[model samples]
Target: MFYGKYYLLFFISCSPFCLLGQKAVGIGTSNPRVTLEVAGDAITRDGIEIGVIDDMVDADTSTFLVQEDASNKLKTLDVSNPTGTALGYIQEYIIENPNEDWVLNLDTNISATEFVVNTISAYYNRELDIDGYATVPNFSAYIQDGTWRLTADFPSANNLYDNEIGTWTITTLIYSRDLSKQLGTITIPMNNGSEGSHANPIID
Candidate 1:
């Protein structure tokens, strides 16, 4: 009876080690293909740390985490070799005349290499009161000489008795090639003519 009890105790103690060495451990699964596999979602009270090194480094907006297929390792990528889209910068401008070619200056932090002009788009939401009717003007925004420009082809007043006056809210969306980088939006307030009796149809 003493020998039988000792054998039972030894088997119970070595059973876990034998099972670990034989097959992988699985949670919520009958079969596990890896060292440790979870068939369902898992929750980690402490934040997960990736990569081989355990250094404490802060991640920025331009930083991305990726897993390598061959090595099966996690790594961090920056804007230089970004894996996905990144948020860029934004700048705004106010112009008094839409008929004139207005030059836009970029922000100091924005680099030309970060965005392309082809991916930039501009739009405006405003209508002119002409002859007791609403009329929309042709406005355009483009980049030239390494700077953004805005222009408009507004229709002239019907006669000397008529005058055009209002404010236009123009928005520009800028992005990089392959849509990997979004440069941000530009809000422009365009003021046409003046208020009161001094208002004229002249577009300068």
Candidate 2:
């Protein structure tokens, strides 16, 4: 009867685990429809990593993580207009006179409705010369005709005979209105040189 008693003790010890295996486990709810369910927020110390662990080592700022509606699985959602938002730089934009405006044709496929543009960086500086300096130029960007356009305005200056040279570079960022997605970036570089009759001429 000693052997029989030991076997009964063993069965009693294993009974709870066997029942747990077949039933759903609920942390904050009495009734759980899934294998594991939490009624409230759950926190993980190590962080939740989706997709293949090895493949997820690298992180992309342009992509976001979202749960798929059909599969109910987490996946990486890439920016929709990767190629459509690409912008080419202008090799040479000339500004022959002061207070003159130049239109820079941006080579891009960004749509007005899908994304908005903002100037993240705008910088202009005239060449270091004695008694010859130019004020900071104005800049504006917009999307039109299935592309982008940049307008540069050089304020009027009395020093027309002053020989000044420098460069202006503007970096623009394109993203969704909600700011959830980053479409792309554009950098425009303008080389300026003005001497004699020309007010503020851009060579390159």
Candidate 3:
């Protein structure tokens, strides 16, 4: 008789947990796909603090990551063009490319509906791709005869700062090439290095 009364009290105490076992727990999803499936926007309230320092290392550390140009700017060309249609101008592209394989477009903003012929450089002939043959290529434009050069890359990802310095390097230029003096140098504050800024890399 005493055992039956003790058993009844135990069942009543565990009744709430037994009922919960019949229903699946969900955070944001009404019908969870898995045991712990989470659905919805998630944001951390604080900066991630790592327990170990080894997690910061990566497999590939060569070539700094560059952000693509935010927008295309029109700059007046000092070089004169033989055409009488209009003033000479080129697209001053300022961008960042993570892959480092930047393709120069005549105009990224150019639409099929618009009729515009961008001016080409007298000193060089450019194209959408290297050696693709161009019609008045103005950027990545090769000189009639030029030598490809190499230079140092831009500030590494580890050297990034909060204050963005105005840059003309455009995904900005790094270890860039200087095809007949077309590649300009990137000056960084007091340590400006233009001698080997644009390293002309021949695309294979």
Candidate 4:
């Protein structure tokens, strides 16, 4: 009868590919394996699938940038020590460092939990169109029984067209952390290369 209906149409077209046999190809595949690892050699067995490590969210803690003391007049000192303990002074430190605007006379506002800072002392007057010079000084302090004795002297480049002045005195030895309440500021950096208006001095 037509060779048993051609063997029942080749067993119903192979019975849906033998009922989907021998699967497991790759990543939930239907014979989809572009390379799930299958080297050579007959007897080989290897399986290592490690991928799913997602759990990290913690990073936010970095903020401490202080530098904004452009002078607002808060230099006070009224004295009182030897247990009667007292602190408050800045009398004056006005050179806002505007490239060394020159003019600072702070003789006393003493405060030292410890002391020793004097490396700034200057005097200038030699002109010839100014050629080379530099200066940078900043300091402000106040705390539990304040204390400081710093020094510095710098500023000199007189030659090349007159008006070359200098004066730098930076000394430090400030201390006061017993009761905790510290406040200090200092930053000096001056590089001169003649061009007009180069005067620095007066930090008594």
lDDT of 3 by residue, 67-156 (tens): 234633323332234442222234444434322332333234333222222322222111123243333312342112232211212222
By TM-score, the candidates rank as 2, 1, 4, 3
Model 4 ranges off by over 4 Å: 1-88, 93-111, 114-130, 133-147, 155-175, 181-204
What local lDDT score does residue 144 receive in model 4, on the 0 to 100 scale? 31
lDDT of 2 at 165: 43
lDDT for model 3 comes to 0.36
Using lDDT as the measure, what is the rank order of every candidate, best first?
2, 1, 4, 3
Off by over 4 Å in 2: 1-63, 67-73, 77-107, 125-136, 157-166, 177-204
Predicted candidate 3, C-alpha RMSD: 21.5
Candidate 3 matches the true fold with a TM-score of 0.19
- As for TM-score, the candidate ahead, 1 or 3, is 1
For model 4 the TM-score comes to 0.20
Query: Cα miss at 185, model 2 (Å)?
Result: 24
| Candidate 3, residue 177: lDDT | 22
Pick by TM-score: which candidate is best? Answer: 2
Write one digit per residue (lDDT tens) for candidate 1, span 143-168.
55555555544454232223333333
Give the Å shift of residue 111 in candidate 1. Answer: 6.3
What's model 1's overall lDDT?
0.50
Give TM per candidate: 0.32, 0.37, 0.19, 0.20
